[model samples]
Target chain A: MRFIFKTAYEQDIRLFKHGGQQFWYGLLGVALLAAPWVLDDYFLGQLTFILIYGIVGLGLMLLSGYTGLISLGHAAFLAVGAYTQAILAAKGWPFPFSLTAAALLAAATGIVVGLPALRVKGIYLAIATMAFGFIVEEVLARWEHVTGGNTGIIVGQLQMFGWTADSEESFYYVALVVAALVTLGVLNLLRSPTGRAFVAIRDSEISARSMGIHLARYKTTSFALSAAITGIAGALYAHKLRIITPEQFTILQSIEYLMMIVVGGIGSVHGAFFGAAFLIVLPQIVAMVKDYLPPAIGQATGLQPTIFGLVLVAVILFEPYGIYGRWLKIRTFFQLFPLYRRGLFRRQKAFMKSERLR
Target chain B: MQVLQVVISGISQGLIYGLIALGFVLIYKATETVNFAQGELMMLGAFLGLTAVTFGMPFWAALPLAFAGMWVIGILLERVVLRPILGQPAFTVVMVTIGVGFVARGVVTMIPGWGTDTHALAAPFKGELVRAGGLVVGMEHIVVIAATIALSTALYLFFRFTRVGVAMQAASQNQLAAYYMGIPVRRLNSLIWGISAGVAALAGVLLAPITFVHVNMGFIGLKAFPAAVIGGFGSLPGALVGGVIIGVVESLSGVYLPEGFKDIAAYILVLVVLVVKPTGIFGETASKKV
Candidate 1:
């Protein structure tokens, strides 16, 4: 009995400890793979949502979280992707070809939007990106032909290898596979030299440039990559919903994406997953509990944006590093066991140094 | 004659942008953050002016009071929303101000009597026009120019010799050195915010006649931001020139270019500036410290 107790504790510590924490992570990955089979139809739909948004959030994680280019208009890129796919597919193009076009078109638009980053940083860049968002939205509403205007158009259903990817099960499988592949691709890329360049530019662009990283090119390229990924997610989303409208790509949606990155923990790969899942699930959970709440509060939910504003302010104030970052820290604290490390407070002390960097 | 009329109108409209751009420059200089809520501030000021004038106060009588009220509001906003997030990454402050903007717009829309209808400001100088060589200009244009000049002169005087003004200049240029030199940096920052909001209120008061004091009048601030950027965000004089440039460019675009293009001219100007001369026409390149 004593030996078993000691063995279990050691196993937990070994899996949870230090840099080599991939063992339990591997188990979690296997569980996720098996999840779709056991999930009911409704749960399958929710999982589909998680997978789609997870891809979008992952793209954002790379841009805002890692590269330090805070884009408030990512939804515009998603629209570009969605519209491209929708328009092409509506015109009787193949799904596979439409998907490629969607990503390329979104990437092209991202390059033009990202041109502002060459000259500005931080707030100015944010404003520039926002302006681009507004312009894109205005174009969508007014152009009428390309976007189908405010009336919007339904996207043709996706097909794969003579099989319709229509049912919840098939959609979930497709999204899951795409999400998994993209997640893997991102994971691999982050370990590469290009990812290092992104981090370097983000930490200090001047220093990064000094160290022979081309600031303009890397920044723009990172933006293009982020946009392309988001575009893929958007294209997938259009097929999933069977509707493509300018409303799906509004500035508010862009802000929601930003909230996801912030809440999930900026710059962490795992953070994107948490952020996407939280944003998708939290509102449904709110709606569920909302029935039990008092009448006045329920009525106020009509006036209140509620969880959206509260979560944004709370995360930025209390958990600036985000839930994922905090989770990582707590896990680290236990692994470092009995070390009494307070991660957030230590971050505050280090802030002065960070302040001067900006 | 047609071209002359368009140019005059553009210059007149540009003055509105310049006024708001001045607001952007004023706050940006003192605090390194560009308040995205500046446009909403202008909107609030116009709405407040409407309140003052419509509630039986004369236009001139309400103008100064409105300015004073907004100045106080600016100070309060800085202290409450901005000051706490002062040391965070520029992104956090940006989002916070964005939230503040959202709340202000929501609150404004929530007001029962205020938002449901849009009423023209009972301007003391409504329906009046001036003709210069067949180019028609509204009396509002003359007032805007005269009032803008007067306001600019007063600001110039304040910065040139006044103890507080020069101290603000010192602090904005260098906080640590100003602090070492016995200038209260935080106080100066608050004061600058007050002045920015005050100036914005004055601009709104003048703009009420021309733009008719609607919730949408504040969109002028969006165009003005581009003016500040094109003029160099840090330079006060640059903001003025930038505003004029945007005004002229937009005016020309509306007349000469395809229809509906002028609405997007500000963004085009920003894109051009970002691509061609990002340091702006007047802003000096900031050297990176190792």
Candidate 2:
């Protein structure tokens, strides 16, 4: 298998040329599409949330992985969308139209936030976005007329031409389809000229600027684009929960979205889904073990938060690219079996050597 | 007279923020990474102090003990969570800290007795009003303001005069050179983190009286970030100046601005500060490396 895959020719870089990659991706896709049919209500609900986060993660992949601008404020965009859709839906607007408006609202806000990126880079940009998130939450809480003030406004069922999307099953399918479509859109985006420019900025902003790429324009556009996707997810979430409180849009949620990006693999398009799934599954598993704990322990201790912290710490300490990146490598290792390990190590060493040269 | 009182009140509260900013500066000085969880650590400190006080510990004893507890927590946090991710891109480390912050808040809220309920940390000084020639003030407020100033002065003196201080400064200025100079740079880094945590606890313990001690108190850290920016990210004194500026603006806004705007007063102040002087009042512009 290794012999057949290895090539001396530069043109032989076949990602899916081997049957294994195709088979694996195909099987994975099938499983995802089939998930709603087999899963119970609770699991379906959680899966829908994961898909929402995965959609947000796709945006982060573009901004952080592609454009190299770290956004701590993506969740703020999510909040903007969630709040916007809730308000619109409460006013008798169609669900589809509200969701679209949610994306547009987020994109508009994203442009405003992205303008700051023209001046600030990296951590500075992160802080600006962080501030933006805080400001958004404050607005949501205070704007009583539109946002139900501090109490927050609840959203009605997602109505698509008289069909209700209130059940976990319907939401599951909706989430799956939306996630797939958004993922496709994002992957395609990465293949475009703007995507390459984002990659160039990520590698070296000065070189990118030198290459005549409008750094500010692309950098900020990444924020707008990422925010729009996150907003769409937020809109879906608001509809799913039937509640859109300012509390739901805390800065903490922003951190969770970031965790998705990091845990799934910072730059990979698929990393978001992988990261969101891990987070969602871990908590569910934790909850499932709840009954087994001693009453005293269960009553007193916050095992859930403690577990989250430990998982985050563990992930950062070892697999920085997250489980997804590691899984990719592990799959390749198995595909090549014993013979492939040598090739992997060789590639890694060369990669490391080149980094040192840089 | 009322306006003066408000300004004084703002300055005093600002002192506490400045102190928090001091911790931020101290950590940033040693390690370039920002400690997003410092607020949570501070909240933990006040809670610990509350526990200490309720356990019949004397104020002095409880304060110092709580400070020590915070220092240990800080060190443990760095050793367990942060140390491993030292060389990862700044974004990864920041996100880790942010996660750590959430975990801290969640854990604090989860404590059986705490239950997200707000409680007062019984202060030694009764918040009795003192009429200083028609200018009313709380005695406790005076104490907090004084203590922050005194702490800031001590830090300034220590940094200027002491051997360890100078070495730490050297580390902050250039890590490679400090390492080459036989300084235990990594140990120094841990110590800085520890010290920063202690300072944050002190700020929290002091601030807990005015704002009730609860799980959400950790969020005051968000407000403190604006203080850091206002003072200039790298400047210690600027933190003091920035905090006071934000405090006064917040107080005045709450009094005079339309209801909703006061909630965003600190952020607006930060924006103004950033616009006026991006590096902050006392910050020097940094040159990009070639």
Candidate 1 chain A TM is: 0.89
Q: Which residue runs does candidate 2 get wrong by more than 4 Å?
A: A2-19, A89-97, A160-168, A339-358, B107-117, B161-163, B287-290
The per-residue C-alpha lDDT of model 2 at residue B198 equals 90
If chain B of candidate 2 is superposed on the true chain B, what is its TM-score? 0.94
**What C-alpha RMSD separates each model from the true structure?**
4.8, 3.9
State the lDDT of candidate 1 residue by residue for A1-358, as single tens digits. Answer: 0122444545542323433446677777787777767998888888888888889998998898889999988999999988888888877777778888999999999898888887777766776786788778768877887788888878877874567776778778788888988898888778778988999988887789889998889989999999999999998998887887778787678888888878888888888888888888887887877667674554342223445555666676667778886786787677667774664345452121122111
lDDT of 2: 0.77
Q: Against the true structure, whose TM-score is highest?
A: 2
Error of 1 at B1 (Å): 1.5
Query: Over the stretch A236-348, how does candidate 2's per-residue lDDT look in tens digits?
Result: 88887887788877777777778877888878887888888877898778878877877644553557766777677667667767777688778778876766654453322
